[model samples]
Target: MAYTPELSNDQSRTLRRIAWALNMPMTKAMNAVFEYAGNIIDKKRVCAACKDNSKCNTCAFNQKRWSGSPHDHQKNKELCLLSLIKK
Candidate 1:
C-alpha cells in the first residue's frame, strides 16, 4: 500500500499554491522543501570550524563533526566564513 501524509488543510493549500507558482508537480515541490530543510538541520549540527575540512585540523575547538556543536557555539559562529565571501 502507498503511504499518504496527513497535512492540515492550510498546509495542503499552501504547498499546492507553492507548487503551482513553481510550475512543478506537488511531489517535486515537496522533495525540494524536504531537501532544503535537511541540509539546514545538518549544518546546524556543527560549528563552522568543525565543519571545515582544512580548519578542522588546526581548529581551537578540536571537535569532531559527529560530536555536535561546542557548548560556547554562538549563533554568529554557525555561519561559515567561506560562504559569506562571494567567489
Candidate 2:
C-alpha cells in the first residue's frame, strides 16, 4: 500500500499520541488516526471540544447511528462478510 504523507511533524506526533492513548498497534493506530483526521479536514468540520459540544458530525469518537439507510446496512453487511471470509 502507498503511504500517505503526513502534513507535518506535529500532526504526525499528535496522531501517534492519539493511537497510543487508544492502546492500538502502531499500524492500526496510524491508519485510524489519519483516517479520522482526513474526515475532519476534508469535511471542514469544527473540533468537538472547541465547539463545546459533546459530539460533532466528524468526531471519530462519536457513536451515532447509521440507521434508516439501506446502503449503509448493505455496506456494513458486506464488510462483515469480508471479515468472516478473511478469518
Candidate 3:
C-alpha cells in the first residue's frame, strides 16, 4: 500500500506544489521540508505590560515564529511584559 501523508488541505496543497516545483515526489518533498522541529514560548505574563492590554484579553492567541531558528523561542515583542522588565 502506498502511504499518503496526513496533512491539512492547505498543507497538502502547498506541499504538493512545492514537490512539483522541485520535480520530486510529494513524500520526498515532505521529508525534505519537515526535517526539523520548532518551539513555542509562553508569553502570557507579558500581556501585563502591553499597551494593547484590552485587545490581549480577548485575543485567541496562536504562536508565530519569533526567531528565524525554529528551535529557539523568545517573547512576543509587541505584547510581552518581559520587554518592559528587560528595559
Candidate 4:
C-alpha cells in the first residue's frame, strides 16, 4: 500500500489504481504518471499574466484563492486547475 512519499492521499489512490491495473509496483506507476504529467505541464506557464502583479487584482486565480469563490473571469477554472496540478 506504500505509494510515493511525496504523494497526497488522492495521488496515492490514483497511483495505486494505475499500478494495480498495470500490474506494476506503486512507485513505478506513480513515476510513470509523474513523468508524463511533468512533460505535459512543464512547458505550460499556467498564468502568463501572473508575472504581472498588476493583473493579480483582477486575476481569477488570485480572486478565488483569496475569497474561496469563483471570480468573473473567463478562464478561472482552467487556470486554477493548471496551477493546482502538482499541488
* Best-performing candidate as measured by lDDT: 1
Question: In terms of TM-score, which candidate is strongest?
Answer: 1
lDDT of each: 0.52, 0.46, 0.47, 0.49
TM-score of 2: 0.33
From the highest TM-score down, the ranking of the candidates is 1, 4, 3, 2
Give, for candidate 3, the lowest lDDT window spanning 10 residues. Answer: 76-85
Scored by Cα lDDT, where does model 4 land?
0.49
Badly placed stretches (over 4 Å) of model 2 are 1-3, 34-87
Query: Which lDDT tens digits does candidate 2 get at residues 1-87?
Result: 367564588876866675566666556666654444433342333334355454455444333532243224335321221221233
- Candidate 1 clashes between residue pairs 3 or more apart in a chain or in different chains: none
TM-score of each: 0.42, 0.33, 0.35, 0.39
lDDT tens per residue, model 4, 29-81: 65555544533442225454346566555433443334432322324322222
Candidate 1 residue lDDT tens string, 1-87: 278878899998988876776567777767555533433454434555254566564433344532554333334332322232258
TM-score of 3: 0.35
RMSD of each: 12.9, 11.3, 14.8, 13.3
Candidate 3 per-residue lDDT over residues 1-87, each given as its tens digit? 277657899988988886776577887766545432112234454444456545543332313323254433323321221222234
Model 1 poorest 10 in a row by lDDT = 76-85
* Candidate 4 ranges with C-alpha deviation above 4 Å: 1-6, 42-87
Model 4 Cα shift for residue 46 (angstroms)? 7.8
